[model samples]
Target: MDVEYFDYDNYTADIDSNLTTEGTLNLYSASSSSTYALVAVNIIICVLGLAGNSLVIWICGWKMKTTVITIWYISLAISNFLFCALLPFEVVYMITSHWPFGEGLCKLASSALFLNMHSSVFLLVLISTDRCIMVLFPVWSHNHRKVGKAFGAVILMWVLSAFLTVPSLMYRKTTVHGSVIQCHTDYGVRHKAVVLTRFICGFLIPILMIVFCCSVLAIKLRSLTHKSTKPYKIMAALILSFFACWVPYHTFVLLEIDFKKHNLEVIKTGLKVGATLAAANSFLSPVLYVFIGNDFKKTLRRSLSSRIEDALAEDIRTALR
Candidate 1:
């Protein structure tokens, strides 16, 4: 038995099919449109995410004193910045499917993408865990959860994420196929294992940890004497936003394994849509988690200009002195 297939070199599974000319043309057209849309959305997300996360890093790192919460936010912002900065390369690659950036750069880009993604998720897990601990055992958390510990946790997460992304560096390549050099991972015999590992460790396990922590936080908040539950509500919103944005991505990631048995156009469209949603998560995080409070927004607005002016005055005073 012979099978004919169309190859989508980046992130899609092998398609085994014998299709009519019209069907193939439709698939190609659909894929092209989806790729264009995905790239466009990624560009938008890149701009907004970079700006948003940059502000977050500045605010949390410079304007405020270091704390456990600020450390977590800064870590998240740094990862998001790296992810957003790398998005332009993806846009270029998607537009031309021709890898002009050499194989080493291709591997680096792929590895960084996964590294940032996993790091972001793990940071979210850390934040959730910290909040849960604070709610459940305020005295213990107050005494034990220091900024230094948060920094250590962030460093550990980055090391773990790098280790997880080693597969990307090993498997990724820019292969010339029919005059088009495509950048993609060629996992070979490890394809299924890689996919399963990513789904389990990257998505499922972290999300489970987040959910458990959030649940405990919620229960503790409900049992408290204070009727105000604003903190819990904010945390819930953050978790819900993350799940909404990433569930599609992880779902399509698993489904791509069986994409040969599915409709090509549907699978491709779903994958693009999922990627856009997941990318948008980086842009949304700063607003949802850090800037949602009215007091925070007002303080930022009021302080930015005054802070700049004050710094300039201080510089002049030092010069005069």
Candidate 2:
């Protein structure tokens, strides 16, 4: 969802306005209104995601009592906030099709994006693991799910994310394309390996692990004959929504690596749509948490922080009982 999309070779576009004497394509187009529309959508997403996630951080980090679950949610919200913060840079670059931020900023932005994504997904995995353990081994979970442990795990997740994001940081660069300066990654000789590695590590492994943990939790609940299947249902929905958002992005990434020449229009459109969907996932998390954790209609009256505090209190009471 980050500059990974820009890991392709020298890109050429059909929009004709920014052509130089040497005939290179600019990032934006004066003629292509669709690009502007996509940029508009990104801007909206940026504002909403930033505002919503800030509230989440305030509530989860400051208002709520520390718990394993709250720790995980805090980590998730932080990732969402950081990711949304970088969208404005992307918006400007997309609008003018120019990289005015210089090489250092470009690398930093790209690295931050990848870091957020990797951290976000891994945190989900940790949440799922914690939920599974809580359900299956309640006593052990109660004894062992300490806030310090969760904090340590979150720190490890960030370390892993930062380490994995090295490729983007190393490869992202600014180059002059025709008359316009463009920022993108040059995957060069390691393109296929990098693409496959990212797909497997960034998407496949986490999802598979999530699905496994959720499935095990579901079966355990079923065997116990629990009447309220709402938690399981919400977990399923969360995983499904994740797959829906990311599958297209990863699929298009793989296709773009190989079929970049075959379907120019489709590839370009898919890239735009995929990035939007992926970025939109940030704001969607807080919504999903609110809906799944509380009575959606009832929570509407109170502010988001109040609603989150109420829902988290409910969760703690449930866990204790």
TM-score against truth, every candidate: 0.81, 0.88
Residues forming the 10-long window of minimal summed lDDT in candidate 1: 1-10
Best by TM-score: 2
Per-residue C-alpha lDDT of model 2 across residues 76-117, encoded as one tens digit per residue: 889989988877887777677778889998888666656766
What total of clashing residue pairs does each candidate reach? 0, 0
Runs of candidate 2 exceeding 4 Å displacement: 1-30, 177-179, 230-234, 293-297
Q: What TM-score does candidate 2 reach?
A: 0.88
Residues 1-321, candidate 1: write the lDDT tens digits: 000011233333333353322122222223465666666677888898898788777766676666666677678889889888877776777666566888997877656656766888898898788777766776887678777787789899999999888888887766665776656666656766787887789878999999888778767767868545444444566567778987887776677666666776676666667767877877876666444444665547664434423332332233222
Model 1, residue pairs in steric clash: none
RMSD (CA, angstroms), candidate 2: 3.5
Backbone clashes, candidate 1: 0
Report how far residue 186 has shifted in candidate 2, in Å.
0.7
